[model samples]
Each structure stands twice: as C-alpha cells, then as structure tokens.
Target: MPTPSYPPKPSPGDRIAVVSPSSGLPGLFPRPYELGLARLREEFGLEPVEYPATRRMGATPQERADDLHAAFADPEVKAVVASIGGDDQITVLPLLDRELLRSCPKPFFGWSDNTNLLAFLYDCGVVGYHGGSVMCELGRPGAMHPMTAESLRAALFTSGPYELRPAERWNDVDRDWADPATFESEPRSRPGGGWSWINADRVVEGRSWGGNLEILSWLLMADRAIARDESAYDGGVLILETSEELPGATEVFRILRCMGERGLLRRFPALLTARAKSWSFERPNNPQQAARYAADQRAAVERALRAYAPDTMAVFDVDFGHTDPQLVIPYGGTVRVDGPARRITVTY
Candidate 1:
C-alpha cells in the first residue's frame, strides 16, 4: 500500500459533515446532540451539516453509506465527524466507495466503533482522526475538557507535529445521556497518575494502526480493515483500548493472543494502550473495583506481549480512547513514541 497522507484541514468557517455512520444515539438523546452542534458552531466556528441518517436511530448500512458518500462528495463539506459510534458499523464498510472517498479525502473523526471507518480510510491512503465524536466529546457534560478541546482545535485547523500530553485529571465514569440531570453537572473524574512506560529503551516513529480493542476483534473476525499482508503493519505503532462495555481481562488476553496466532501481533515494535474505561452505567464500579480492572487489563496486555512481542515497547494509560479528556490521535499519520524521553507526539 502507498503511504497515507493527511487530509486537508478545515478552516474555522468551513462546513463539516456530522453523520451517524454507526449508531444514531442522537435520536434517542437529543440534548447532547444539540449541545454538540451548538458547540461546533459557537466554539469551533464551523457549521455542522447533518445528513438524514445523522439522528435516525437504527439506520441501515446503505443509509449510513449514502450519508457518508454525500458528506465526502460535497465540496462544501470540509470535514466529516461522527455523531457517535455504535455496533454494526462493520456492516457499512462493504457499501463504501473507495474511489469516491479517495477523490475527496477529508478529516474524519470518531472513536469507539468508528475505528472501522478510520482503518478503512487508512487503507484508502487517507489519514483520519481517532477522537472527537460530537455527542461524547463536544457535548461533554458541563464543559469540554481543556486538554481535549485544545488537542481537537489543533487537529481540526492545523497540520503539523503536535506533542500529546497526559491528562492531569481523567474520568472513566460516565453519566446517563438520556437524563436531563446528567447535563446539569460535569461528570466526575479522578486525579491522574500519568502514563507508565515499559521497556523504555528507544524511540519509535511510525504511523498509528489499531483502535478500540473490541472493535478491532470484530473487524478481524469479519476480515475487514486489517491488512491481509501482515507486513503492512511493520514498524507501525499498535494502539489498543477497551470501551465502556468493560470486557474482562481474560477477553483482552484472548484477543491479542489470537492476533499473535495470526502472526500479526509482533509486527509493531511499540504499543500505546489507552487508559481503560473502567466505570460504566451498566457496571458502576467503585474506585477499588475500577483500580483492579485497570490493573488486570494491564496485566493481561503484559502477558500477551511476553508471549508474542516480548521486546515491544509499551506505554499504558495514555488518555485517548473511551476515557474523558480524550486526546485526538492521527489515524494513519505519523506518531513518534519517544520511549527514552517519555513523550508521545503525533502528526495532525
């Protein structure tokens, strides 16, 4: 495959497409969706253009693909962002027109299930973004996290190397988006312990490859996004993070092991394991339980690495996945993991 190039950045006044290529949670909870749209206009100074499937829950794959095609094909649309991510986005992958998107590459930002789209864009030779969902990040309860807002602003407008900073205060817990009371106050967060580096011996620079762990597992099962030639990932940084579903440590280990079995795990020399999302509305884990969850997840990762990529350098708890104060990572773009300096930088 050819080297992936960064898509053009959008100006403040430019229009952006906000579509729900996956799940349309905006229909179920309009509060955050509207608030997110307002922020896009007021704070970002960008007009958010929503497609028909943007707020329509249970939109079929064809409808979502049509919205994506329309969004990318429109000259007025300078960027494309997801309203939110949900399951079943893998179904939409088959319907996308590679040549159409390649003809008009735009910065696409979304995480969680949107991993499918990012990976797809990478293979299409266009760089996408791995964060900044509308309802979750922009419409975050109370106010946007300072770190998140700053990182997103830079990615949206600028194109250059940007150093990533670990969040001083991070949140794993989430409030009910459906409840009006959830919007009255900010979600709770805890003091961050910063990132922990393992095998911090050398710096590694390469494009990023990987996303929400569970989502990637699904893609692997479907034989989607991931390169058939394992060498396509050679020297690239592997990024992995779990979502709010709170899959157990054993599950994490099993998935990585499967990748290793396929000769895909040891290709990347470095790994950036996102801070695990510990608390969820379904499983309101206490502080102690949350800590255990994080610890076990880390242990599982270590166990898998020892068996597969034993020499790979790893940095755990980087705030970029399902965590609050999410950082924007450049999908298919350059990432410099400076193990010796204990810093991570990405090309925006």
Candidate 2:
C-alpha cells in the first residue's frame, strides 16, 4: 500500500466533528461526555460540533455512517474525533461511503472499536490517530492527565516527529463517572514498572498498524480493513492494547496465535504492546492482582512473538491504550522504534 497522507492540522478555534461511530454512551452518561466537550473548548481551544447520532442510542449503522460522512465532507470541520469506542463499529464499515471519505480525508482520532475506522482509513490511504477518544482520555474523571494532554496537543496542532516518553506514573483504575467524588481529584496511580523490551538491538522505522487486540481479532475474523495480502503490513509498527474488558493471558495468546497462523506476525519487525488494564468495576483487582495481570500479559506477548516472529523487537507497558496518561499513536503514519536507544518516535 502507498503511504497515507495526513490532513492539515486543526487550528485552535477550528470546528471539529465529535461523532459516536460505535455506541451512544454519551447520551446515557453525559457527565464525562459534557466534561470532555468542555475540555475540548477550554484546554484545546477547539469547538466540538456534534452530529445527530453522536448521542443517539440504538442508532442504525447507516445513521452512524452518515455522521462520519458528514464530518469528513464538511469543509469547516478540520478534524473528526470519536466520542468513545463501542463493540459494534465493524457493522458501520459497510455503510460508509468510501468515495466520500477518500475525497474529504480529514484527520480522525479514536481507539478501541474505532480501530475499525482507523484501519478503514488506512486502506483508503488516509492516516488516522489511534488514541484520544473524548470520553476516556479527554473526559477523564478529574483532570486531563498531564502526559495525555501534552501528547494530544502535539498530535492535534503539530505536524512533525514527536518522541514518546514512558509515563513515570500510570493508572489502570477506574472511577464511577456518576459519582460526584470522581471528579474531585486525580485518580490514584502507581509507579510505572517501566517498559519491558525483548530483542532490543535494532531500530525499525515504518508506518503504524494495529489497535485494541480484541478488536483486531474481530477484524481479522471478519476480514474487514485488513489488506488482502499480509505482505502489505511488512515493516509497519504493530501496536496492540487490551481494553477494560481485559482478556486473559491465554486469550491474548490465542489471538496472536491466530494472527501468526494467518502470516500476520512476521510482517512487522517492531511491536508496541500497551500497559494492560487490570482493574474494572466488574472485577476490582487489587494492586497485587494487577501486577500479576500485567506480568502474564507480557509473557503472553513474548510467547506469541517467539513462536512466530522470533527476531521482532517487542516493548510492553508503553501506556498508549486503555490506561491513564495514554500517549497518542499515529495509525498509518510513521513510527520509529529504536530498541538500542530505548526510544520511540512518531510522525504526526
């Protein structure tokens, strides 16, 4: 595939489309959604314009696709951001008018289920951002994470190479958005264990691909947004992260195993696995359990890569997805993974 082109960055006062391509949780829980919008205006100095389906629950796939089409087609909307990610965005992919998006080519920011759109945009030859959902990162309960804010601002305004730094402290814990206390202060965070590296001898520079692991599994199963030939991904940086619905180590290994079986694992020489999200409302794991969870996840990744792509350089706990102080990663854009230098840089 050809190198995808990035759309122009949005100016501070420019209007940005905020759409819900997946779930309309914004309507159900407006607290974080509203707070996210406020921050977009106050912190980023950008105006967020919402489409009809942005907050509409049970919106049809066509309706969601329409919102995306409108967002990209609108001349005034410089960028498009997802309100949040959901489970069923793959269904909306077929409803999208590819020609419309191909022509308009606006910058899109999202992760998780939004991986569907990011992969779609990549196939369409337009670069999209893999992180920065409004509800999760922007609508963060208390204040925006300093690292997240800085990474987001750079991705939004700048158009150059940006180096990613490991978060000194990161949080995987969650707060009840409905509870007023959640917004009172920052969520407690633990000291970062730091990134774990395997095969740290070389540097690899290439375009980026991949997203939430479970979502990518679904995409691979459905054969959506994936290139017809696995070779299309050769030299691309593979980024993978687990969501709040944390899949166990065995499950993680199974997904990667499938990718390997399909000849996908050998295509990329560098991999960036995100910090595992161990705690959720449904399963409130203590710090000890969280530590074990992350350790197991790391081992699972190593096992998969060892079996499939033994020489691939891999880094874990990089804090890019489903974790606090998340960094922004460019999908279909350039990423340089320097294992020898212990540095990762992305071209926005």
Candidate 3:
C-alpha cells in the first residue's frame, strides 16, 4: 500500500458536502439533522451542502456512489460528512469510481457504516476521518459535549498532532429521535474512570486502521477494501468498536479469530478499542446488565488476542465510535500511542 496523505482540511466558509452515503435518517429525523446543520454553520462556521440522495431513504447503491463522486470531484466542496449510518453501505462499494475519488481527494468524516468509505479511501491512498457524523455528534441533544467539540474543532481546521482524552462523563444510552422531548435535554452520563491499558510497556506509533467491528467483518467476507498483503498492516495501530446493534460476545470473538486466521491480527503492535456501546432501544438493558455486557465484550477480545496477538498493547474505553462525545480518528493517518506515558495522539 502507498503512503496515505491527509486531504486538505475545510475552512470556515468552505462548502462541505453532507451526503447520506448509507441511510437518509435525516428525512425521518429532521430535528437532529437540522440541528446538526445549524451547528455546522453556527458553531463550526462551515456551510453544509446536501446532495439529492442525502435525505432520500432507500437510495440505490448507484445513486449513493454518484453522490460520493460528486462530493469528492467538486473542487468547491472541501470536505464530506455523513448524515448518519446504516446497515448496507457495503453494497455501494463496488459502484464507486475509485479513479475519480483518488484524483480529487477531500477529507471525509463519518463512522459506523461510513467505515466502508473510509476504508475505501484509505485503499485509494487518501486519509479519511472515522468519526463525527452530522446527526449524531454535531446534532447531539442539548449542547455538544465540551471534549467532543474541542477535538472536532482542532481536527476540522488544524494540521498537527492532537492528543485523545477520555471523556470526564460519557454516555451510551440513546434518546428517541422520534420524540421532540429527546432534544430538550442532554443525554445522561456517568463518571468515566479513564482508559484501561493492557501490556503498556512501550510506545507504538504507526498509521491507524480498522473501524466498526461488524462492518469490517462484512468487508472481510466480501473481500473488499482490506489489504491483500497482511504485511500492509505491520506496525499499524488497530482501532475497533462495536456498533449500536451490539453483537454478542461470541460473535465478536469469532470475528477476530477469523481475522487472526487470515494473519491480520498479529501485525499490529497496539490496539485501541472504543468504549463499548451498551444500550439500545431494541434491547435496553438496565445498568447492571449494561456493565456485564461491556465486561463480556472485553473478555471476548482478550480471549481472541491471547489466542493470536498476545504481544499487542490494548487500550479499552477510549471515547469514540457509537458512544456520546466521540473523537475523530483519522483512517490511514499517523497515530502515536504512548503506552508508557498513557497518552494517544493523532495527526490531522
């Protein structure tokens, strides 16, 4: 793989594309979408430009690809942001015009299903951001989390190393977007105990890789953007997080085991696992249940690593992925994991 470079960052007045490369939850939940757009303009001072398929749910794969092409190919659009995530973005991968995106690269920010595009862009030799979806982060109910806002501000306009910090208070429970009352207050959170490190004897710095665990499994099964040469990931820091779907512990272990079988797990010297999302409307477990859920997931990860990459350094409960107060992780960009100092930094 060629060295991936960061795309030019967007300026305050620049027009940034807001496309739903996955799902158009914007149409259904206009409250958060509009709030997010307002924050983009008022708080971030950037103009958000939406495409035709952005608000149209069930848009075909070709239509989504066209929007991606238009956004990346347009010189006026300095960046691309996803409105929200969906389940089937993998379908749009093959339809994408790699040459077009490669020739006209721009910073793209999103997570979850957007992992597909971020992975694709990384393969195209362009670094893409792996957090800050419009509806979820920017449109967060009440005020944006202070840590999240500060981190995003630095990422959007700055070009230097920014350290990642654990949220003082973090939340995994989500409010009902369908209820207007949900937007009336901030999501409740509990005190964060900070990151837990495993095998923190040395520092590791390398290009970052990985995203939503479930989506990556899909990509691996389809033989998509993952590098054909296992050596491509040598020395890279692996980032993994589960989604709102909350796959079982056994499933998570099985997925990583498969990656290890393919010789992909042992290459990374360090790993950063996003704080596990423990709550969802479909399976709303109580506090005790949620705690057990997270513990089980962590145990599952440890089991897989013991069987494969036992030497790798692992950090758990870093604030990113499906949790509130998400941090923007650069896909294919350089990351510095200082285990001895207990610090993590990424270049934008």
lDDT of each: 0.93, 0.93, 0.93
Clashes of 3: 0
lDDT value, candidate 1, whole model: 0.93
> Residue 175's C-alpha lDDT in candidate 1?
79
lDDT of 1 at 46: 100
Q: Candidate 2: where are CA atoms >4 Å away?
A: none
Q: Per-residue lDDT for 1-348 in model 3, tens only?
A: 667898889889999999999998999999999999999999999999999999999899999999999999889999999999999999999999988988998999999999999999988899989898899999999988888888888888999999998888999999889999999999999988799999999999999999999999999999999887769889999999999999999999999999899888899999999999999999899989999999999999999999999999999999988998899888999999999999999998
| True-vs-predicted CA distance for residue 216, candidate 3, Å | 0.4
lDDT of residue 41 for candidate 3: 97
TM-score of 1: 0.99
TM-score for each prediction?
0.99, 0.99, 0.99
42-68 in candidate 1: lDDT tens per residue?
A: 999999999999999888999999999
Clashes of each: 0, 0, 0
Q: How close is candidate 3 to the true structure, as a TM-score?
A: 0.99
For 1-348, candidate 2 gives per-residue lDDT tens digits of 556889889999999999999999999989899999999999999999999999999999999999999899999999999999999999999888887988899889999999999999998889999889898899998799999999999999999999999999998888888887888888898888788898999999999999999999999999898887668799999999999998999999999999999889999999999989999999899889988988899899999998999999998889899999999999999999999999999999
